[model samples]
Target chain A: MTETGEPEIDLLSHYARSLGIEVSGFEDGVPVLCVSGIDAIEGRPGHFHGGATSGLMETAAYALLRLALHERGEQAQLKPINITVQFLAAAKKEPLFAKARITKLGRRSANVTVEAWQEERDRPRASAVMNVMIARSEPEAT
Target chain B: MEKEAPHRDPANVFDPEKAAPFLFAGGHPGWLGLTYLGHGEDWTEIRLPWREELMGDDVRRVIASGPIFSMLDMGGGIAIWTRARRFVPIATLDMRVDYQRPAGERADVIARCECYRTTRSAAFVRGIAHDGDPDDPVATMAAVYMTIGDFNPAGAKND
Candidate 1:
């Protein structure tokens, strides 16, 4: 739980660890996550696949949402309502980076903006806006 | 007499023309085959083989936004993997998608993304999915990826 009174799920940490992402450095606001490369994730003739990038974007948004909720002293599970993104460029031979921030924070919903870049941050390869709905934290009926 | 057809490539590979058969299926009634076409420098493209199972409520119709979103999720994952320096299966923390227009009955869906920069703890990435039509789009999305280890692009081993 954070000072705001919300509990942290360590979403980024748990998720990245499961995927074998090796990352360093982190701040309370935003953090950088990493993953390794493999054949199952190849795109086109031989470049990096795009689907992978989309997954990263979606996951990042979730992580950010979790953080925000924790800061507000609220207990809630975040569900994405919608997301819009534009592919400005491509990434060839470097680890992709995602930068996320809250665009709108409401009682029932939250909006976030995320940018993905390859080697350079100035020239974003892709950008996205995610809309999320806050739901009561409940375990799925497994 | 019944003759059997030769074993060709799996329904899903990366053929743009054949992709329609897979992508156009919409949310028919069965599983479909798809793949990544690879995007720009750090992005990834997800391609699927058009299949009859994609038919939707309209019979001759394609899949629905729900299924399309599922495909996007897969595509997005591939995009992140493309940018990853090492071999790891990253998971989606959360994602949201907006449908600009219904997906056309042509070409495969290329979900391009890039995990360009990573801070000390969080990895940021963004991407888009296009079936070729730049003027219009089937859907657009953005998401964030979290890393487990120290992201090392220079330490990648391409298979």
Candidate 2:
């Protein structure tokens, strides 16, 4: 695991893990998340749950933000301020994928954009814009 | 095109009690342990109990944003059904959630949604999620849903 740039600790939350979300690697130095259509995240029988997709997208956003924090060698706690999700398509029972990037990274906050897709990357099943507040584990330097 | 399955006749009144079991049985709502609490003419209230497994920030002891977001989405759907009284089929077109604070430690979340307006092909909704007090909410949501009498499970341009 150390050989690769992936973090040694798990980036996903317990709920995400229960839904079968995983860190599938990275895209241009950003972490990507993937999940199989399990019963836990099932929606309308044959489709993925809307909330499950939102969760995966949020996890990806956090993953991207966490990496940035790691790069700065800073330990911080994240507080979600807002998330706006746009449902683009109904997902089927298959491997769902998501990735996020930092649109703006400030000293105490970040804005991220994440997209969830299945099969075709061009066509996203859902996309979200997220704003997170960072509470530093240690006080910022004067 | 997929064949249409037999569905309940469209009515003007919705009963959350009757729909609870079917809606929360085996889907993501089931996994989240969602329950129907009560409803009004155009609104629905649902609950999500506390579970260690659903915590977002382990240290803060707060429920993740995803679960709260999920709850609001489902609550909004039920509200639409309650208002429209026609549970034909609905999809979340867009939702914007603003977090005022995180859920209290080990506190169950209560969400209430209202379908304020409905057109021929869409519904607009608003809701709030709180741990104990409705006055002080953990989050608030504004959403839009596309209502279609004939639902297709395959996919839609805006699902």
| Best model per lDDT | 2
**In candidate 1, what are the lDDT values of residues A94-134, reduced to their tens digit?**
47666678888888888888777766779976677777777
Runs of candidate 2 with Cα error greater than 4 angstroms are A139-142, B1-13, B150-159
Backbone clashes, candidate 1: 94
lDDT of 2 by residue, A110-140 (tens): 9999999999999999999999999888775
Give the range of the ten consecutive residues with the poorest summed lDDT in model 1 chain B.
B1-10
Model 2 agreement with the true structure over B6-119: per-residue lDDT tens digits: 223453345676777778877799999999999998999999998988988668676788999999999999998777564657889999999999899888999999999877
Model 1, position A127, has a per-residue lDDT of: 70
For model 1, the docking class works out as: incorrect
**Where does the lowest 10-residue lDDT sum fall in candidate 1 chain A?**
A13-22
